[model samples]
Target: MPHDHEHPHSLLPPEPALRVKALETILTQKRLVDPAALDEIIDIYETKIGPRNGAHVVAKAWMDPDFKAALLADATAVVSELGYYGRQGEHMVAVENTDDVHNMVVCTLCSCYPWPLLGIPPTWYKSDAYRARSVREPRKVLADFGVELPVDTAVRVWDSTAEVRYLVIPQRPAGTDGMDEAALMALITRDSMIGTGLAIAP
Candidate 1:
């Protein structure tokens, strides 16, 4: 899902899921691609890793001020300490959202993302409309994602690049002081880390 450029979306028809299956079938028939490898890759993202991984990182940051400081300073090293850094996540930056500021991330050129901490990119993250609209009209774009900020809160859009991917550390929600890190993680959504959604309330 990572690319580096304002490359136009593929003209492939709207039925990409089916089209991909057809292509995969053909590649298997010709023995050009390994189905086992494909399955493994899919399974890895679906089960082994996903937003929950990032949620854990976020929850820890919410609980530990020192850790949060380290994360904001250098997310790569802080996350790597938990063994979540590789591939498209080589360079990482954590953007914290405050009471008066809301942050949103978009890859203007590509779907550059931190796959280790956040897993593979979501389907919409790879859409051209999102890439084009996020920077231009972030508040409106966020509203479409069901995120409506207060009138006084300033919206900050972060454009992720191949060199450095940004992760939004959404503000910790209220009524969570009694909750443990693991419990708090369950309230964190992938979109929250992507700056497209907010953490769920208890």
Candidate 2:
């Protein structure tokens, strides 16, 4: 039931649901929606349309001590320095993930994501299923996403409200002591900022 896309609580209207269901049924019958299309869409959106601003911020923070300090102190000003400021990001905080704790974000009500950096919210992220389940069973929800935290690690759930949005600055992975900015950006996934995945080791 958790995976069901239809429920009275869904924000989608009945007409849209019917059309989507019909399309899904047709797609299943014809096998028309290519599996690779999903990845292709993601690639286009992330690389072409989605702002690389967040990755830029992360790289600068890693390389410049003063900028990093300013970012930790006030993310908005630091972001504006790169001409990446936006309505949602006007007041942002870069929470650093550590060994003792992990962070995950949820809106609890609507899907309030860092669109200037991450682009459109993923379908799963906007679903009522995720919104309800995240608060009720955060660990389980995270585990379902393949993010397994240690038993002793505390999970901090930051509910994005109407006023503020949050982004996580995942700790730089090891074995990349001398990696440059471009290479480092390749390792920063949207999930890392959302706190659902750790940055991969370069």
Candidate 3:
């Protein structure tokens, strides 16, 4: 007979996260780990770092044509000038989305993402479904992500590898011309940089 009951572990967090939580709990009980410190670290990554760095780059590009040109020409050098370079981000390529072209990025192999600029890869980005579907049916994937590109817009999927990581610079929304870089940064989402979504409108 086939098993009818769900496995107990199925209800727990995914394997890696479950293991980390278990370890944290054990260390906390032993008074070896400071939960407060861990929380602060998590908060920093979740809010203050990663995607914010990419947003800053996007905002600057939106404001400065020279920087935008330089970013597209040599993403690694230009981005590093802003102090956002590190492992998993050594080689960077910036692709711009325009009225005629839409760029989407995916790691067909393991998730070789730009960790410094984008923070940790989202769980969805690392999934086998996304890795395969994003390349095979980019329009459908984008639609599922709530991004409906125009029929005339050409969708281009870039495969990210350890040698090169691509960042999508979403087209600046209309009426955002008066906004400053700080305000502009708020419009840039991580998903936009990943080419799965557009910049938030002001």
Best by lDDT: 3
**Segments of candidate 1 deviating more than 4 angstroms:** 1-32
Per-residue lDDT of model 1, residues 69-181, tens digit only? 99999999998998888878889899999989988888889788888888888889989989999999998888898889999999888887657878899998989997998
Per-residue lDDT tens digits for candidate 2, residues 4-103, read 6656446334588786666656676798876578679778666754536677788777777798889889987777777766756667778878888888
Stretches off by above 4 angstroms in model 3 are 1-48
RMSD of 3: 5.5
Better of 1 and 3 by TM-score: 1
Please list the residue runs of candidate 2 whose C-alpha ends up more than 4 Å from where it truly belongs after superposition. Answer: 1-51
- Tell me the TM-score of each prediction against the true structure: 0.84, 0.74, 0.79
Candidate 1: pairs in clash: none
For TM-score, the strongest prediction is: 1
Please count the clashing residue pairs in each candidate, in the order shown.
0, 0, 0
- The order of the candidates by lDDT, greatest first, is 3, 1, 2
lDDT of 2 at 44: 62
Residues 1-202 of candidate 3: C-alpha lDDT, one tens digit per residue: 4355967455446788887798788789999999999999789678865898999999999999999999999999999999988878889999999999999989998898888799989999999999989989999999889989888999999987557988899999999988999999999999999999999988
Model 2 lowest lDDT segment of ten: 5-14
TM-score of 1: 0.84
